[model samples]
Target: MSHVFPRHTRQAPPVAVAGDGCYLIDASGKRYLDGSGGAAVSCLGHSDSAIIEAIKTQVDSLAFAHTGFFTSEPAEKLADLLVANAPDGLDRVYLVSGGSEATEAAIKLARQYWVEKGRPEKGRLIARKQSYHGNTIGALSAGGNEWRRAQFGPLLLDVSHIAPCYEYRERAETETAEEYGLRAAQALEDEILRLGPDTVMAFMAEPVVGATAGALTPAPGYFKRIREICDKYDVLLILDEVMCGMGRTGSLFACEQDGIAPDIACIAKGLGAGYQPIGAMLCTAEIYAAIEAGSGFFQHGHTYIGHPTAAAAGHAVVSAILERGLVPRVREQGDKLAARLTERFGQHPHVGDLRGRGLFRGIELVADRDTKAPFDPARGVAGKIKKAAFEAGLICYPMSGTIDGKTGDHVLLAPPFIIEDAQIDELVDKLDTAIAAAV
Candidate 1:
């Protein structure tokens, strides 16, 4: 038996031997189309010569440099590029290894900002229920996924979880989409008041809920209201785009489409495009200035905080994203993908909703179409669909507990921006087959 620790101990996974474009080849020579980009990380696909060469050149020249002693060229360049393209007021980048680190840094940075501003009592954090930030203890504490947090309650910090802006399930029949968005956003205001706004340091949420809720896009005007609320209460707004940013949502930042910017944002996943492990937490100049003027330090870091090779990969990946005109291409191709999904599963008996923007789309499943009832959690609809899709040589992301962390199921599709029209059809066809087989 293999000694390696696996995510699922009962199953032995295939050894991936090679990656070509959007497909992965196993040791047995079986090819599986990467329909979900391996949890939406591979935006440029597997065989990008530019990124690979950048990584090689960086390592050959200078790979390891402690951030405390010296700043590397690639890290500086990557930070500049990210800040240049980031939302307004987000001018600083705290580089980390992956999504969890980015989020952990963001949380700590928020707390530090409050302390530096001479309001140490503003230490409380607020996150939305059914949202996912990351898996590290601090990140997990900030995330509101009940299932992921159940076993670790003793170690978690006291963070408040308000209702997520999941309009499909939470919006009332009498409300228009815009009205529902404002109403949903009102939960943040309610939580702030309940916690005493003066005690709250920051409010964290995924601009588009990923992982736990499967690309649950916020209702129209939801984030705008959220921004206003944050500003009104002196609470910093933090948007976690680990799974939906870096052109995954057809824009460099998913919040761009919502016409708002956060005081702090955490991004990874697609930043290095699976070429290297890298994530970054960006904050407004005001937050940075607080630390600069007060403590002259943030008082937190990791050993590999600014790995040069990873920075080089992120720089090259981002350069390609912007220079190759992939952003607009993502919009064009995303429309095609959405149309194909609609054509294939819009009216299926088990498919209840098709939602999302850009290449990030989600298909929610239901048992009773009219009533919008979920399948029994014990049935494992999502798990069976994932297995069926993988066996059919198509890789997709399906998860249960989409609604309230226990009831709903959804398949998240986030193909690479380079996906072609023909490949879109192939993805949908394979998913249809898998859904039919599993459901």
Candidate 2:
């Protein structure tokens, strides 16, 4: 009798009634540890009184104000805070509803920047294969996950996908990690030349590949070379930090660790920390100045852009992260979690790789560790793990298609920044049980 549509048609999920710290409680009173932070969204956990009070205070005074007619205080303050802490050169913030909107706006802004510069021919977008940006049309187009794009192929834009900086499977035995990184980055330059440098506008990628490829961290100097190539070709580097930014990767911005900055950056998930629906697309001062000097308009907008209540919530979440010293805590707790995972799964026959930064981590499963071969797609290893974990009162993100878009599986763990040491052990224990049952 339920009319509400679900992501999967055949199964009905338990109704979540409440949240307590890092655990979610269903109507039946089962408490599930939020191991994946609900797709890496709840960085501050479910109940933070400071963020809750901020939302309440803002809503009592002012909730919504159309950005066209006015700019609210909360929105302005949040924007200022974000830019102040953002990567060097990124000075402007365009608030949106969620990750897809942030990335979609980034794409449009990139296109508009080129157009304003009188180079309308620079329209092609290049992204990495096995990357997931967002779900909207433009965001989806920029994303290279084949299975997600299979049915929507006709609706997607023509985007060229280069190989990802995946060190594990792609690196050759002959090359050192640094050598492999440089070789991987060369693909971007090669693709830009093949497509004609003048025809390419921007290159988009996640600093730590999530979802589609799990938390796939780039090798040393990988992003540095990417930054260099983009600079040399006059191509904009658009980093999608939707699921990995906002201190999720131990830095306010994930690219900071890579020692590079993007021409444009997209962030969400941890921004509002599941307290509100909010995302922001930040750009370099140069890009913002282009529109300011020319059209004085970005020619793109959403009705919910600059929503005050969401802004207030985001501001509080970020302030809590910075003021309460949670970023370093993420690094500290992340080390513990990583060590626990390695200790538990390092010798497991099916566990192929354990990788990621900060609280964001990934565990790739394989049929043969020696050959690094994936489990057969028909085995549904990821799906089974997810089900088993959930049944055991744990919530983790496990996805298929970690290799291409079909033949691999990985479990992504992104627990809250406030998680305790005992909780870390609990998370790994539950995950170990899940993997054992699944594989």
Candidate 3:
């Protein structure tokens, strides 16, 4: 009987005692390969010496510093590095404790930016129905994961959910990938016109849809059309990269591959590489200038916003990512992983789709390959796969409701950047065995 609340009420998880390389060790000395990098948070693997040393040194010197009173060295340096490497026009960073907080701040910041710029009526937000931003009240409101938002519907703010750029299921047989992408992006324009562009503040989306939709990459030219629409309508573009950013998709920012920049972008997960709880909401110079010129404050604060220890950890993690040339390594290893997955699961009857970019991959299961129909929801395929995988000593993210909130199943794979070629085989083998046992 444990007093601490857990995500699953019926079953308790093993007590993880240590992590070495990409494997986590339980108290019983069992090792589980981190196939999904613990929800894609540990990009540097579990035992990163540089990050550990940085955290220790920072805590030994100065552990905490409230953002209200003073700024810390690590925070400043980290912000500078992030801004330097961030998408074009994004010039500022607002540190937060996690992904949810970063998204909440982004939503509020967008609203505030419109208000300060004499467009207070522009309060409506538009997101994709298959996307997920975060879990906080504001963040949840922006997210379109129906299952997660089902219970909190009454409390959520009004947000418009347009069609996601999911080429796998949504694209038509007659249209080319580029044609489907443009057609999908047209949904945003249609929604913006329906809501009256002046009444719309921001359009939020993930460059690569993770978690809910299982690493759903957009079709070619999708984001370019999205960017054009946002520009034409004067609506801010907010890209939520909480799960797919920070080198998870090979590049430091997932949007880089998309070849577009957002007015605001939220990033976390791999930023601290599981060494610290940290996330940041980055904004364009234009948006930052609006707040600076009007209110002189963004109207957001958290006690731990600029915690020195966390900043130190982030700085070290990012430094390692850049200096150690891990981003290129992510691309190289990601290709190998994809090739291996394709070779293994391409012909598997249950595996319908194998898609994604870099290291963030998704395997969608289907009941009928020809029809691409999902297994019945009652079957609990996702849940069963998760259990079997864990029991088989492999940690992967398996979630239900890939098509919508109620149906479809997919397994998301986001291994660490440090994973070796041999480890990739191990990951795929364990997952193969797990799927066999589960199905």
Candidate 4:
């Protein structure tokens, strides 16, 4: 029996002893290729000398200073770097220790912004079905996953959930992809109108729906329409990219690919590349000004809001990603990865779809490919696939409940930005074997 409480009480997982590039070696010396970057977190791979050195260097100088007292160089430099390349009008960074904390801060900040602007009634949050933001109570309340929220239902605050932009499942057979995109995007407007628009505070979603729905990407013009609705209603748009941002989706910010920017965005996972714990909530200049001019302060603070060593790791990671041109490489290799996956599984009897953007991709598995019918959840297909993948020495992010949080299964692949062509082949090969065995 282990004293450290593992995530799943019934099963104690393999002990990860070391990580070399995209592979993690367990205590037993089994090497598993990190095909999903540990749930799309590690973009620069597990071992990067520069990032490691940056963390050590910052720690040697300064580790932590209370945000209320002093500001650190690494934090200042990171904020500057992020704002310089952030989506349009986003001028400030509110750093946090992890994804859940970042989201909690974003939700509270959105409320505070409205309060400062004298729109205190705007407190309702709108999210989408099959979407995930984080696990904190606030973020959990904002999420739409039934399985996650069912037990905590009594504790979770009321929030609205609309249809997700899931083309393969939600799109009507006769509708064109673009029309389906438009129709899906229209849900927000309908929901807002039903709720009497002004009562709503923020509309939050993942640019590429991660974790909960197996890397579901929005259809063309979907986010464009979403932007229009949010603009018309004056509802703050919060893109929760904790699992999909920071160049995992080919661009520095996934919103860049969608061609629309959010009023506020939460980013983590790849920002520190696993070298340190760091997440950030970045916001538009107008939003920042609302609070700055009203109360002269944003009424939120965490002890580790801006730790120096973690900030140094984040700054170095972001700087290296842009300076070394890893973003373009992610895009290019992502195309090749998609092509290879399609070639391998596009026609498989159990494979229904291969979709996603950049290095982030998903392979939805089905019992019947023609109808795109999901395997019964009782079968536990996703869990079986994961076990098989691990047995085969491959680490892929596979999740069930791809549809309505219960029935569907998908395998998500988010390899490191530094992944090579040969590594892609190895990834696919292992996945192919795993899927075959699992089925």
Candidate 5:
């Protein structure tokens, strides 16, 4: 019997022994294709010698350095590399241990920026429904997924929740995609007004919604209008790219495709490529300058915020992504994967919508395709699909509560950027088998 606390107490999971490219080997030598990159973290596959060597080199010299006293070379270089490739106006990086820490920092930074600017009343945040930022108190409060916050209601901050820009289910038949996007974006403006724009500090959202909503892509013009609204209201825009950024969406930053930059952004997952646990929160020059000029300190940090070894791993992973031209490869392979999914499940009675961009994709399962009705929660469709896929030597992300946090299901695919054509075919074939067995 093992003393380790697992995610689910009722079931015993297979012991993963090793990773090779896009596949994970279990103790029994079962090779399971890493179809979801272990929650979209491993973009360079599992056996990248370059990243491993970088970690080894850094640990040989200095493994860790507390940020309260000094900063390491790897940390400085990693921050510079991230800001150099980040969206416009984002000039500084606040390194953290993982996605939750990054988002938590973004929230605190937004609040502090307002206080420094003499707007102490601007402490409230506004985020869209069905979104997942992170699991920390601040980040969880900013996320609008009801199921995640149900038990922690009293501890959550009072954040205004607005409707998501989900074109598939919310868009009317009369409106065009662009029109629907604008109408959806209007929710932010409406919420700001209702909450008194002066009281709102920032609006946070994922560039491409992940986890809670799968790879839900924004409609055309959605984020551009959102940027305009934020500017008009003096509210900061914070884009959470924890799961979709770092060349996973055919761009270094997922917001690049939307043609707009945020005042602050959070990134993780692929930042360390599974070699190390690292994340960063980036802010505009103006925001950084505000804190620098006021208290000279942001007033928030963790012991492992700038672990030197993790920084070295992140630097190497990012360098590999850019130097090897994986961003363009994501686009090229993403198109092929999308085409294969369409060809296989386009007309399937149970598959409702196929959507996403780059290598991130989602397949919403529905009982009635014509009506877009979801399967009953009691049926456990998503859980069954996940089990079937894993049993069939595949690892995919299938989650329930995709629609409103309790009523829908979706299978999210985010294969490593190095996945080949043969692996793509294998993924689709195994997914087909899983869906057929589950639904």
Candidate 6:
């Protein structure tokens, strides 16, 4: 009987005692490869002495300080580092505890920015189906995951959700990739026109859709069209890069590959590299100026906002990523990872699609390759694959509902930036066995 409640009540998971590089060791001395970086969080892997020392130093110097009164050195330094490396026009940063908090803050901040600009009527948010922002009410409303928003629908805000850019399942057979990309992106324009652009506050989408839709990357010129649509309507563009950003996609920011800059961006997971619980919301100068010039305060604050210890960890983790040239390393190694996955799964009957960018990859599981039909949700394919991989001493992120909220399945692979070539081979081998057993 454990007093600490777990994510799953009936089954108590393993007690991880230690982390070394890309492996987590259970108390029983069993080691498991961290193929998904623990939900794409640990980019620096485990046992980073620099980040560990930074956290300890900050704890000793100043553990906690309310942002209402004082801002600590670590917090400021972290913000500066993030801003310096962030996308163009993104000038200010707001620190939060986790990805969800960062997303909620970005949503509310976007709304408040419009209010400050005397456009309070622009409060409606638009997002895409098969997308995920966060779990909080506002964030959940922005998210389009059906299972997550099912019963809670009544409590959620009336945010409109359009189609996602999932080429494997959503693209028509006759359409070219570019044509599919344009058609998929055009959905946003259609929705905006139907809703009246002035009433729409912002359009949010993940650069590479994570969690709910696996690691779905947009097609060529997809984002450019979306950017044009937003600009045409004076609607704000908010890219939720919480999962695929911070070098997960082989670039510092995943949007860099799309060749567009968002009005506001929410990034996490890789930001602190699991060294600490940290997330950040960054905005353009225009958005910041609206709040700075009017009322002069962004109405938001979490108890742990700008926490010195988390900030110190974030600073150290980010510095370690840049200083060690990990970003380029991801690009180089990610190519190998993708090549290996393609070679292994490209012909596998159950593997409907093997796609993604950089370390963040997705393997779509299907019942029939010809039709791309998903396995029955009742089959529990995702959970079974997860358990099988764990038994084989591998830890990969397997998710269901890759197509709709209840239909498809996919395995999301996000091994640490420090993962070795040998480990990559071991991961694919173990995954091969796991998928065999699950299907």
lDDT of 4 by residue, 1-439 (tens): 6899788898889899999998999999989999999878889988899999998888888989999999999999999999999999899999999999999999999999999999989999999989998898999998998988899999998999998999988888799999999999999999999999889999999999999888899999999999999999999999999988999988999999999999999999999998999999999999999988998899888899998889999999999999999999999999999999999998999999899999999999999998889998998998998999889988999999989988899999999999989999999999999999888
Better of 2 and 4 by TM-score: 2
For candidate 3, write residues 181-203 as lDDT tens digits. Answer: 99999999999999999899999
Candidate 4 or 2, higher lDDT: 2
Off-target runs (Cα >4 Å) in candidate 5 are: none
Local error of candidate 4 at 250, Å?
0.8
Compute the lDDT of residue 2 as modeled in candidate 1: 90
Q: Which window of 10 residues has the lowest lDDT sum in candidate 2? A: 1-10
TM-scores of all candidate predictions against the true structure: 0.99, 0.99, 0.99, 0.99, 0.99, 0.99
lDDT of 5 at 126: 94
Clashing pairs in 6: none
lDDT of each: 0.93, 0.96, 0.94, 0.93, 0.95, 0.93
List clashing residue pairs in candidate 4: none
Q: List clash counts for every candidate, in order.
A: 0, 0, 0, 0, 0, 0
Clashes of 4: 0
Worst 10 residues of 5 by lDDT: 159-168
* Candidate 2 regions with alpha-carbon error over 4 angstroms: none
Q: What does the lDDT read for residue 397 in candidate 2?
A: 99
Where does candidate 5 clash, by residue pair?
A: none
**TM-score of structure candidate 2:** 0.99
- C-alpha positional error of residue 292 in candidate 2 after TM-score superposition, expressed in Å: 0.9
